[model samples]
Target chain A: MKILVCISNVPDTTTKIVIGADDKNINTAGIQWIINPWDELALTRALELKDAGKISEVVVANVGTAITEATLRKSLATGADRAIRVNTEPADAWTVASNLSEVVKNEPFDIILCGIESSDHNGSSVGGLLAGMLDLNFISSVSGLDIENEKLTVQREIDGEKEILETQGPVLLVIQKGIAIVPRIPSMRGIMQARTKPLQIVEATSSESMTETVQVTLPPEKGKCKMIDAENAGEVIRLLREEAKVL
Target chain B: MNILIYTETREGSFKKQGFELISYAKALSGMTGGEVISLAIGEIFDEELKKAADYGASRIIALEADQLPDNRNLSKLLIQWIKQANAQVILFADNNTGKAIAPFVAAGLKAGIATGITGLPEKTDPFIVTRKIYSGKALAKIQVKSHYKILLLAANTFGIKNDPVVPVIERHNIEAEYFESPNKIISTEKQTGKILLGEAEIVVSAGRGMKSPDNWGSIEELAQILGAATACSRPVSDEGWRPHGEHVGQTGKVINPNIYFAFGISGAIQHVAGISGSKVIVAVNKDHEAPIFNVADYGIVGDVNQVLPKMIEAARKIKTE
Candidate 1:
């Protein structure tokens, strides 16, 4: 079986997000970018499946500016067999999903995996949008996934319990945090091999769509940090009611 | 004026959080002197619609359609809904589903969006809504200057209260377009835990100091006994000891429960951002200078391995009493 992992280039979680002076874009100055954390899970799981000889090739796909090539290369270093870069300025989730869907139409993979949400925007809309656009069976927040004989078993976290699901292959799986293995670093040999690996860059099939960002402002300031001096649990309750008004 | 609320359901049953969305919509409706109308798509739940009245909904709308299973199509359907009802504002349950579709609905309606909102809109010239930004590190007062407004509220942000009067169900037809791409309905699987983090009243999260993945068993046991959910710090997940889904950090899931207990966590800024909304935060760590103590309602500076067992025993005793 062949697997495709959709990745996103986003700011690191530790970055201090700031709106630019124009208030229409994120301030990219001094901020480090990484492959989105959730996407790491997808890449990691793909590597694990490859190690188990479950699949032949792991294709890493991303939609973003040319700078995103670095992100695709990083995924290649981690474990992806090949990389596909759809060169475009990443706009809204819809635009990205449309580009991915168009590229995916040319290639028919048995399973498609992606992160549930991106770190920079926190939109959490792309996977669902792509599934809707492609008209494929899709599941979000999948914590566990196992594939055998073209049949896939997935575990999703619901409100109060987990629900086990079964579906056929060629389905889209939007990975949540707990679903997959942690990423592994590339060895010296592997890193050298990645240099020779196929890293194809293609222009986005979709046309440029206009998405207007009105403004981005900082959140309001919080009140002075309130501390509760408590000797016991009962005192905690008192502070909650009297001081915090939270209980 | 009309106010619309998006309700969530699972396995033909309505989630309790859906009612909280109703309460929030009702509050907004009261401010506008409008009636609160709900839109419940997906699996059917007849009895759950009856509970919306007590929470402040004047009318309940049920779209008993299987085609509207996912949020993408659901948001498209709601577009015609807002036009039909002429809804001023739409309220959504701020879970995975709600968050997925809200931005789409906002974009479609050309409305401003505010997510992770904790409360209703404060009456100012341009309506101001309060939400947590920077992962609960700060509160953001957003002034949405749009003809139609869309708000997705955080889960557990509102406390559920029982109302004396039952709400009236006014069935309304939803304008829906079928998903032509033959998306099949497959099976869903459950996670390995006694209680879900969103629904749990209490939560006990551990950090890197637990040392090994094997040590999680004790945390799970205590959580099982207390009917609590188990959570972890980002490093624990980064170190491969726990799943990333169990992580609580700035980029991870934010949980707000009645009681949140932390063990072996150093309370880094990113980790603390996720739990700042918890009602009562309790910290247990060996470091007296840990930042978690700054926000914890109760702090116990000691070795968590030695303290957790005894605390669990004491908690069990209290419960039996």
Candidate 2:
């Protein structure tokens, strides 16, 4: 079965967040962007499945303006069979999901893979939202997915148990960690080939965004870590009880 | 206006997050002048279903189902009652189950939503909610323009309260095959009786300073003493000193415990991304300049083997006093 892995381009995880002048977004100056770490893992897993002959094709898709093409090219270089970019600035998870729905429905892919949450917005909703819009089965927090002997099984982390789930086709799995050990790097040969790979751009249907950011602010500045003498560990406990009150 | 909260029960009992939603629901109700009506869809018990009343639910709607449908089907089912109540606002716990269903429900209702909301709505004039975003380093104040709104409260953020109210319980029956799906549960590996790291209010995590996997007993003992969960850094898990499930970092599980005790860990930015949501962080490391100390609210300059036993004994003695 063909797989469509939905990826998000997000600021690097270590980027120090500085709110922009508009108070609604981050300062884009000198911000490094990459395929979101989790989605990178998803693309890695899909390519692995394709390599194993269990999957027919691996297509990577993202919803963002042209700025997202670099991340999509990185996906192609890492061995996605094709790349699709939905042209628009995603306002919210619903808008991203709606645009991705158009791309998924246009393809014959049976499975869609999404990162559990993007490190940037961290909404953890786009996968399920798209599943609802497309009337496909939804599973979240999936740590493992395999297609063995033409049957699909998924490992989902529930409250305290790991549920092994078996399903037919046409499912969207919100991938958590453990799907791929280490994300694949683009080989020199693959990078050269990626230039000629199809980078399809689709106009966004521009569904109404369900939410909008009013303002973004950093947390209140706090005091530095209070150091205590090693010999006076007991006093630290007292401070926890009386001062921090977290004990 | 009415607020509809989707609550869940496990083994016929409510988990801490269940009441947390109640706490959030109560706070949301107070802010918006909305009554808190809870909806639970599962094998709810007669006595267990009434627990929400103690937490100030005005009325409880229980949908008893032997076999719960998948998240998408459950969304369709919930859309029924969500509209029936004409709820202006909806609240859900931002966990595995809630994340799976809440988004679909929002789509069904065409409601504006904010998941993993760390606190109550900042404003109702334009329907704004504040949530942790971008690796917990920033807060995004989101404005939901839709007439209906959905908010999923994060675990351990909203404090559950004891507000007594005699709630009316309305029971409904749902069939096992309510929706068509082709998914089956194969097996469940249950980590019974152990505190899960995700929901853990207190977490005791260690790094390579322990030196080997053999020293892990102390970490588990310390976690047991504090009724906390045990976690490790990515390197420890990568080295197979601990299971991947116990690893917390940018790649592994991200945790937001109330108290996070880091023993011997020189905090990497990836590790900080995971625990950055924590309210209070305590670090015990020999290196005074370790990056872990930068984020830690409290720190001790000491070796893990020596400081760990002392902290355990002190905590044991202090708890009794």
Candidate 3:
């Protein structure tokens, strides 16, 4: 079995996000980037399957500009057999999925995995759009997965319930954090090996973006917190109802 | 112009977010001078259908089915209805199910799609909307230049107001073909007799400061008294002290409750991102300098072990009064 894991390069979660001077994008100065946390989890799972011999190879794919190659190299170092970088600045989820669909049509893989949503945009649309474009069965919010003899079983969350689902081969999954909670770190040996591995660059075929970013702004600053004495705990409830009017 | 809203149902009743979507659609229709039409599929109740009318649906379309199919199947069914109604704009709740299917439907219609939207369109001429990006750390105003548009409204961003109006009900007996999906539901497990965390107005959450899972009893009791949902920080869930469903953070479920009470939790940037959209935030932590205090509307510098019991007692007393 061959697996394709879609990866995204996003700003570190702890980075202080500052809107650019133009107010159309984020400030890039002195900002650290990392593999999208959820996608890291998905990649870790794919590597585990490869280690178990369930998968013959793991191919990591990303849709972004040239700068994203650094992140793809990190994924390769983390254990992907090879990496494919679709050269494009992802304007929207539709554009990203369209480019990915072009790659999926060329690469034959038994399973396609992606983070349920990118931590940056949180659009949660690409995986579904890709599945739609390719006419493949898709599952979202997957928490558990198992494969046996080309058959797959998945556990997905719905509202307040967990649904255990069974499927056949060649499936797409928008995975949440369950298969592997902790992400894998690149070993020294793996880093050396990744430099010799294939880092293929494909020009984006889809040029149309359905949505355009008009501006970016921070949320309005909340008012100062009213500090209450711990001794008078009852006042907290009163304030919540009267002053805050939320209770 | 005709606007279509997908009103999703669990079991036979509409979810609370469904009404919120209807309320939002009504406002959008008012702006565009369009008609609001609701489409529901599966085993639906008349009372639920009436609720949609009460909210502001001008017309309701129902498709009866024995089971709710997967997202791919549902999207196929929706495309047929969308074409039949000739809807210009489509809306869905930004929940698990909506996130799964809305994109598929949008792709099929060749429509521009936006999810996690925080506000109404600033301009509808070219159709521009605002949504949170970088997890609530920043908001982006997006313009969709397409013939058709799809949007998923973020939870708690819009208030649901009842504009009670009778709606015309139309039953469509259409034979929809379902794809041969590799996915099959084998079993389901539900958290019985508890308000769903996603829809709760008030949420009480805890972190590692609570010490152990044994200490969660007081948190649950307080949540019960206030008719609120119980949530946890990522560390608490990672430690297996709480179910993953109750986890609220950047990597977990993004919540937008009216009031979010953080007990014994240091505010990490990831956790703050999830609750930034909340209306009122209250933090109770022993460390007064905790980062959570930066975004909180109310702060109590005390230990959770001591403060929680007192707060719970005060809440119980107020309820009895």
The residue-by-residue lDDT of candidate 2 on B1-321, one tens digit each, is 689989877766666688888877887788889688999888878888888988889989999876677777889888888889888898888877787888888778888779878887778878888887876778889999988898888788877888879888899887556656778889988777888787899999999988888998988987888899999998898787987788887766767788999988999887887888899999999988899988999999998888888888888887888
Candidate 2 ranges with C-alpha deviation above 4 Å: none
For this target, which candidate reaches the highest TM-score against the unseen true structure?
Answer: 3
lDDT of 1 by residue, A59-137 (tens): 9899988888878887888878999988888656657887988878989888899797776655565776676667666
Candidate 2: give the clashing pairs: none
Instruction: Grade the docking of candidate 1.
Output: incorrect
The TM-score of chain B in candidate 2 is 0.94
Best-fitting candidate, scored by DockQ: 3
Listed per prediction, chain B TM-scores read: 0.91, 0.94, 0.96
* Candidate 2 CAPRI category: medium
| Model 3 C-alpha lDDT per residue in residues A1-247, reported as the tens digit of each score | 8899999999888888988999899998987788998899999988988898788899999999988888899999999999999998988888899999999999867899989899898999889889888878888889887777777888897656888999876889999887787899899999999999999999999888888899999988878888988887667888888888988
- For model 1, the local distance difference test gives 0.73
Instruction: Arrange candidates by DockQ, descending.
Output: 3, 2, 1
Which ranking of candidates, highest lDDT first? 3, 2, 1
**Two-chain DockQ for model 3:** 0.79
